[model samples]
Target: MEEKILTGRLYDVQGFSVQDGPGVRTTAFLKGCPLHCPWCHSPESQAFYKQLSWMSMRCLGVDACKQRCIKACPKNAIELGVTQKDVKTGTDLQLIHVKRDLCDNCGKCADACYVEALYLCGKDYTVDELVNRLLQDKKFYDRSGGGVTISGGEALSQLDFVIAVLKRLKNEGIHTALDTTGYAEWEKIAMTMPYVDLYLYDLKHLNSEKHQAVVGVPNEVILDNALKLAENGKKLQIRIPVIPMFNHDEKNIRDTAQFCKRLGNAVEVVQLLPYHNLGVMKYLRLSDDPVAEATLPNDAYIEKLKRIFEEYGLPVTVH
Candidate 1:
């Protein structure tokens, strides 16, 4: 009897990623997240299904391309000269446009875009295919104390596929890291615990209401799951994004440090990811309008936050 192949949706597989986990790692960016964080640098990772994206710089305009996307779209989604502000430079220019309401993400227009001005955000990867891509850097992982880090939009969203991928990595003797928001049901997350070597758990905000206002979910379940993971003797590297005006105040930072303190020895490191506008340009690919850029955290501010974490006697690192 032939075994059926399992496939999962992926946003991207980033190679030689030192920031995702310890060592030189190949980070598998699984698609889909429960959180709708406004500060999200990767807008494309939010949806469960694939989404059409437009790269204005790559576009040759309606005249050059002969309205290929406009003509190919079954729903008449593409149009000439709707509006454009150069994504790289803020100046305006005429570029091909995608009609948001009419587009069903059918991807026929993307197929017609030879220049890749129109493209899809997510792709299907079989377990074998993804595993092969991860294994390409096995030598680097072995030598650098690095391994495969399964990061998401929230890896737990695709629980079954993640479990299968993690299990296979563990079988191959690769150090497996699960980077997650701790936003799924406990049972679904529990399935991956056995295979995960380390957890890169994300902590957004401490207050449930404040958390919900920004991220579309409460913090109670996420915090509870973290506690559960620690209780079960799982190693965790707590990742907190130091977003300005959102959760970077003294009280929140202190309270977060306090939470990490309570998590105790299960926590390996408290990594503070300072918020930046580095991903603001990506929003251009996913939206009709430009995203309002947030105030970026300075080095001094990030250092101050790190010192606060250290006040709780928690091991802290800034990246």
Candidate 2:
């Protein structure tokens, strides 16, 4: 039998990202996540498949583009303007509409839209192809102590592909980080742990009920996984998204500090990611789902929270 090609779907591969991990790194945003956090940063990471997005801001009026998208789409999924109920205040023309159900995410329409008004969100990459692209930045990683970071709709969701690419990178002596939601089987974690040099762990809430209420999943498994990884001698970068009306209270902040203390020396660093509306536009492009209204936590307030963690003898940083 011929050797099989192992491929994975990723919405984006961002280069020179200082925000993802230490040094200059390439971050591959993979598709498919188990959790449904409304305030997720990458809108495309929610689904496990390819998506078609229409950037109303980029669209020229129908007359100017000469209806190229409509002509390109064989399924008639491209139309002119969304229904009044779906319209937002941004664009008056609302030049194109994507009938998502009818659309199969074909790139013909995206190709026709020279202004990038219509575009596909994800692309499939064979394991070797992805590794080669990442390795291109080896010089930068070498000088900066940076490597590749695999983030997802939960990276472990596509366990085999992630394992393949990370294992390859490890063999090449490059550092690797797994930015995960911690919603996977322990066996999956075990296999990938050896390949990952660092774990970017999401610690959303200490209370399971509140976690489930907001993210559609309880925190028990997530918390359990964190402890296990720490106990197993893995370095962890704990991330907390400070959002109003969810997991932003001082009580929760202090509780998180206590929890970090439990992780002991394995807790490498705690990153406080304040809420931002950066995902609003991306959300609108992906679906008709309501973008949960959130405001940026004030720097002063975030600093105050940082002190709580410091008091517990845990190093904390705000991003």
Candidate 3:
């Protein structure tokens, strides 16, 4: 049988990135996630379709478009000018109506607009295409011990595509890392492990009920994957997003530390990514809800969390 080719959705291919993994690296942001974590930072990555993001601030009004989008839309979804509607509270709500169902993915509207107010979010690329783009940063990779990091809504959602890309990178002598939620099938994780040199594992919550409540999924599978990876001696860096009113309590921190301790020497480090509103604008662009509305933890809260991890003798970094 002939081998099947795999393709994946990518939102961005960032180069010369240092924070994602070791050294200067190329990061591939894959699309289509399974979990709906209420505090998700990248809400635009959730859907498995080509999304049109409208930045009202970037829009140059009706004069720029020549009404191209209004004509192109089949469902009459695109209407020029401000659309006003009454809210449930009996107040008028003004919104730009872009008939989503009428969009044909032609991107004519985006092309017509000069200021780039309307843009598509997802693009499909073959492994070779992505590899070529990644190799452009080879010089940086060589200097920083960085190669490529595949992150996503969830990298495992596109397992086959990721496997092909990772294998190709490994063949080219590039060190690879996977930033995952560890929510996929074990066999899939095992298949990709040989090619992946590092795993940036996300541990959202310790309690099963709380995990489900916050992330829309139980923690059992994720925990199991971590344990399995540790037992197999995979290089792992566990990360937790410090969201207020969620998993920021001392008990949760201590519990996470204990879990890491059980994973033994396989787990190298823990990173606390303080919640930020950097991605809030993306929510508005995609017309999605803002998940990280809570205020970011103060320096003292962060320091206390770091101390909790230090008690386990585990190396921790706050970012």
What are the runs in model 2 whose C-alpha is more than 4 Å off? 82-94
RMSD per prediction, one decimal?
A: 2.8, 3.4, 4.9
The digit string of per-residue lDDT tens for model 3 on 1-319 reads 9986678999889888887889999999998888887667777788777788888766544544556556656566677557444443454434356665666656777766667778888999999999999988888888878889999989899988999899899998999999999998899999998999999999988999998887788989999999999999899999999989999999998999999999989877899998887877887777644445888799998999999999999999998
Q: After superposing candidate 1 on the true structure, give the runs of residues whose Cα lies further than 4 Å from its correct spot.
A: 1-4, 82-94
Best by TM-score: 1
Evaluate all candidate structures by whole-model CA lDDT and list the values in order: 0.89, 0.89, 0.84
lDDT of 2 by residue, 40-142 (tens): 8787899897888988867666777799999999999878874232245444453777887788987899999899888889999999999999999999999
Q: Which residue pairs collide, candidate 1?
A: none
For candidate 1, what is the lDDT? 0.89
Model 1 agreement with the true structure over 43-66: per-residue lDDT tens digits: 889999899998877875676677
Q: Give the candidates in order of TM-score, highest first.
A: 1, 2, 3
Model 3 compared with the native: what TM-score? 0.91
